[model samples]
Target: MTGRGATTVWHEENIKRTFEWSAGAIFAIPLNVSCQHFNVSKDEPVRLLAGTNMPHLMNLFHNEDFIFRNPFRFHDRFSNDADYFRHNKRLTVRSWETNLIQDVNAFPLDDYPMKGKGVRIMRFGIAGTTYGCHIQEFPVGSRSTFHRHGPGAIVTVTQGTGFAMVWREGEERRRFEIRPGSIYSPGDLMYHGHFNTGHTTMRHFAMRGRSPKYSQDRYRTPLHDMIPFEEEPPEIHKEYLEELAENGITEAVSVVKE
Candidate 1:
């Protein structure tokens, strides 16, 4: 997610293409393609975070050589087009179906008031993969509604600082401190929410197994899974105020009323 680098991909018919990227750049490699990454800067090391379903694939195939050295070419998923990695301006609902996002930190987002106050989000469909990704931002002193979904979501904090409360039904909640570059994943069906304590808006990117367009029954999160602000326990808000106080933030940043 940091530094500058380039990826060279060898596609079908011996076609080769190179994509250059920097911090906040998001892209996906075509399935079964031969690709190599290079760090462009000598002084700064590159850190690329990738999410894949390789574990499931490995378990299903039970063969490393076939999985890694397969000759199968997903011709429909990739092409020799010169603008394959260019940013796509088209958006379906809040989703952007593209191969690359130049800088997610600077990308505009659409309002998602259902998630929380002053929250914005943009979902991404990358490289025709069933996997999904999205960028979400919530205002400071605010928190998202507690919700639960199936596992396989890897979240990376890209801006601001805060903490996440995670738990299961009828269990004690655990607080995990979060800051820029922090990565975490909530376990299967675990209830979780984020609280932004920093002065600026908190933003995070999540790559998961379910996509907005491609519905998967195994990973679907029903509407009833979300715990509304009014339904949450009073102690949740009480502890949030306590945390804000500990951080020396006394501003009257109105939180969602319980």
Candidate 2:
């Protein structure tokens, strides 16, 4: 290696050292550190999804590096202290840097009753992670069952047009319109349902924490019956037709029993 080539080699070696020193930290990127990745084999491609507390940190710090060096230092040795994390579950912060990726087609959709036709879900849960997410799809006119779960949910609509309806036990139901750019957070334990009243299929990325309450039971409670393939009562059918016409939706929807 000579001149620029030699400099590049030096830089690469320094970065390798940095990664070694920063190992076991959840997404903590120190100041002046850089990263590089390589594909050593034809085994599989990489899929990366990352979230950070940078936004919240920005609100409190004039210097980003200061926060991590102090309070976040523990993250670097988190794996070595599993007992601390298991005991302080609510206070521990989880972070990950992953290179593993798999084809969505490789995983079969769960046959649970909550899913709808043209609807498929791929759950992504990592060991020791408090947060989990899934990529979900709803084909045209498909809608999910009205259900409630323990953990708060944040959703980013990636395609098509739709709306989500949420309601608490005593509160009136609220509907929020969603599109490709929409980001919605329906808080924990709210009864909610999803509708893709579009001509094309709709997709979204959703996330929630694996909190203690989330594991007490099935995690999901249905508020309404499954979507009906057979003819609904005359009044119910009329209401469905009216909604379809009002929304300029030509696609068919399952007649869900209320």
Candidate 3:
């Protein structure tokens, strides 16, 4: 704790503290805990990314009080799947303090047709989680269809390279390259598409709400105006080239020749 806040540590018998984190460390914090993050380095900038399953709770109920109270206070008391007992469902808020992926390829992939493209996905293991996360892979030179949904999503690129094109209705398309450790988000209700420009398969881990009923009926594909790979807009092409050059990427493709 710093910057005008009290540096007080709670008296929890089992609490232990350590300050060792690497490049790809994933950590979690329990709900209603007092915690602080600090950057000890003075010359280098520290970037932090955060993810949570709070959306699942929001989708389950609308009461503001539920945020502070336990949602599953009596979860074990009932076996009924009724609406009233939804708050009684099993809920967990703890995760490995220093979780690391031993091997990305060890996980099995499940391929399915989504929005006209075959997508390979592998769900991560996080028991009692309400949010679903998986590693998604796109084969070389393939692209996903233009799709939109109400739930926002964040994808972190882990392997190969690609680019994501995002746009809203009546808005100009924005292109961004998907490099290793790169993160992209399709803002709520924004139509977005992804393309694997690299020669190898592109892999990214995606996080979003797991409940199908959450923001239901908001996912759509406006295929009528979907842009084809061969007919990609000239402005979008120009932006793609600019991003590649800015990021020191030498790989370039000719849309017309493809």
Candidate 4:
């Protein structure tokens, strides 16, 4: 999450490749690959946040030697190609078919008005993994529509400050304060929304349970699962305005109507 670093990845036949990264960089290691990380900066410490499906795999296999020491190579997922880690900008709809993102905080995103006013988003996959992620941004004083999905999404604030409200249906809403580097995950099927109270645009990265491209689940959330602004509880907007006022923000840009 901070400083600069390099990662050395080893593949079959002793093939080795290294890539450098800085803050906001995102990449995935190929499944079962041997890799090592180095902090390139001498005086600064490098901090990184990573999520994995290893727990699920371990539970299913329940064998350390089979899970960790297996020699099977996923050649289709990764190779020793020199450009394996290069940034790919190709977009299919809102999805970027890339193995790496150089800087997610600055990556251009497409308008996603369905989620909220002034909202933009870009989904991406890494190393053909089912655990992919997306980046979303919204202007200050704006908030996203309330929505819910399955569990296992790690939401990390990449820029600006904000707060999120999470709750189950018919339950009391719980608020969580967030800023750059903050991380939180909503429970399974829990409703959640994010409000931006900072001066600059708010951006966050959500590493999700399954990639949209490769998901096989039959019970994914439907479009109707989202709660429209007009249908939301009146107290939501009132609370958002109070937050903005507390931050000394007199004008509520892109604030949804109650």
The TM-score values for the models, in the order shown, are: 0.90, 0.51, 0.52, 0.91
Once fitted onto the true fold, the runs of candidate 4 whose alpha carbons sit more than 4 angstroms away are 87-91, 216-224, 245-258
Write the residue-wise lDDT of candidate 4 on 147-187 in tens digits.
99888889999999889999998889999889999999999
Candidate with more favorable, higher lDDT: 3 or 4? 4
Candidate 1 local accuracy as lDDT? 0.82
For candidate 1, give the lDDT of residue 245.
Answer: 82
- Which residue runs of candidate 3 sit more than 4 Å off their true CA positions? 1-48, 53-106, 115-118, 211-258
Q: Which is better, 2 or 3, measured by lDDT?
A: 3
Please, what is the whole-model Cα lDDT of each candidate in the order they appear? 0.82, 0.48, 0.52, 0.84
Candidate 1 colliding pairs:
none
**Which numbered prediction scores highest in lDDT against the true structure?**
4
Looking at candidate 3, what is the lDDT of residue 23? 43
For model 2 the local lDDT of residue 210 reads 46
What is the TM-score (0 to 1) of candidate 2? Answer: 0.51
lDDT of 2 by residue, 143-177 (tens): 66665666456777767787887777778777888
Residue-level error in angstroms, candidate 1, position 188 = 1.5
Candidate order (TM-score): 4, 1, 3, 2
RMSD of 1: 2.5
- What is the alpha-carbon lDDT for the whole of candidate 2? 0.48
Query: How far does residue 128 in candidate 2 sit from its true spot (Å)?
Result: 6.6
